[model samples]
Target: MAGLTAAAPVGQPQMLTVVLEGLRSHKGQILVCVTRSADHFPDCTKDPDKRHFAVPVKNGPIPLGTVAPGDYAIAIVHDENGNGKLDTFMGIPREGVGFSRNPVLRFGAPSFGSASFSVAGAPVEQAIRLKYFL
Candidate 1:
């Protein structure tokens, strides 16, 4: 006996869902950036092709969905003033910021290689804790 089989399409794009933790307050939006290049790791504004998303900062984690499959590094900035940019005081960020792998903070943001993770064909989740400098 032969029967029809329902199989998922081959080579479907994967998704990377990021959940941000330790938000200071629910005042503004959360700026999220995902980059596949080391040259444009933390700053998505510098690269016009990089993927960026923004959502309100609630008490819990914020989820981002439907991301393409690939090796990528993520950056998040809690824009407390909804200024569409990370406010800085003397070259240091005043808002809460985070990275995908929660790399050690030495001088500056982590390199793409240090934070990068691969998304094959399944949904991946990353939980990042926000860090505030001020």
Candidate 2:
């Protein structure tokens, strides 16, 4: 009798998917920034280097998908007034914004390293809570 070998399970390439929720209203553009580099910090600030996608939201879970496997950080800002910009007051954001992992925001936005995570060999899911200020 010949011994039979078991076949290994096929691995799927990793993908990062973000589900944006708790949107009060979609008055402006939502910008999603994904990056592999965190050395310079605030990678979203750089014009050409950052991989950014802007989508219009009308209050629901917006799924951002097809992200390749790697170290990455995400930043989302709700340009609530449709000015194509984040409104801030007294060094604090007046409009809705979000970050990966949804770290507790304090005096300033969390560092890229704090929000960075590794994605490999499978799909990853993240639920971001939207923040709003009156």
Candidate 3:
């Protein structure tokens, strides 16, 4: 499968179209994390309820499986090495990274409010442009 969906849904099943842009290379995998928790806005490894999607580099619209209609924030990492984690050097990302709203890049990932978007019963689209800072 391309994504990890919620086990038991809360509301209607909805689809989220995540459009990744500015990919430097199509070598490895695309690791995505979706969460509504402010504390887990970017790195959601601690967010137990977070949704994960691992899609191949070549794509049209990433299939993030099914999700409940609600508010969510997304963080993406182009794992060009397929290391399963965002490889960073001196706290700076060595790979490409992006957020749902294409928030400005700073010392760290944007706050939840900056990258968050609403997922209504209808399908929603998120166009995120990747950034590389090596």
Candidate 4:
């Protein structure tokens, strides 16, 4: 018998890919948060699995590989100043920001349900269009 080798097959980590477009500029870091809870929809301070990507001031797509397969909502902010925080002017955002499903921003951020998407065992790709107010 040839070399009988038995190795446990490694399973792929469940993850969600976010394709960000309309970046407008290429001079900041993109802060992406995947949340399974509505209580912390946009603010990812409570989420320990937030993914941050440094993108050019140009438009591109970002993939997040740290998320598990489950229902989750996504929020992204382009910190042009690299301050690691979303800048707002008079209760309005001054930088590029967007959410999953590309929900229209009315008075405030979209609800968790409005920006939520289901992720099964397969890899999921979410396309979000970044919007800037400045």
Candidate closest to the true structure, highest lDDT: 3
> lDDT of candidate 4?
0.77
TM-scores vs. true structure, each candidate: 0.85, 0.77, 0.87, 0.80
TM-score of 3: 0.87
Which runs in model 2 stand beyond 4 Å of their true positions? 1-13, 40-43, 47-49, 58-65
lDDT, candidate 2, 3-80, per-residue tens? 965432235445466778878775778877777777634446674556677788755455566555577788888777
What lDDT does candidate 3 reach at residue 23? Answer: 93
Error in Å for residue 114 of model 4: 0.2
lDDT of 4 by residue, 1-134 (tens): 69965432234446567778887777877877778888888886776655544544445445677565567888989898989888999989999899999999888899999999876546667889888987
Collision pairs in model 3:
none
Q: For each candidate, what is the lDDT?
A: 0.81, 0.72, 0.86, 0.77
lDDT of 3 by residue, 2-117 (tens): 79554434467678788888999999999999998999878888899998768899757887876677889999999999988899899999999999998888888899999988
> Across residues 17-106, which tens digit of lDDT does each residue of candidate 1 receive?
777788888898999998888888899777766888788777554566665657888999999999999999997889999999888866
TM-score winner among the candidates? Answer: 3
User: Which residue pairs collide in model 4, if any?
Assistant: 25-57, 25-58, 26-56, 26-57, 26-58, 27-57
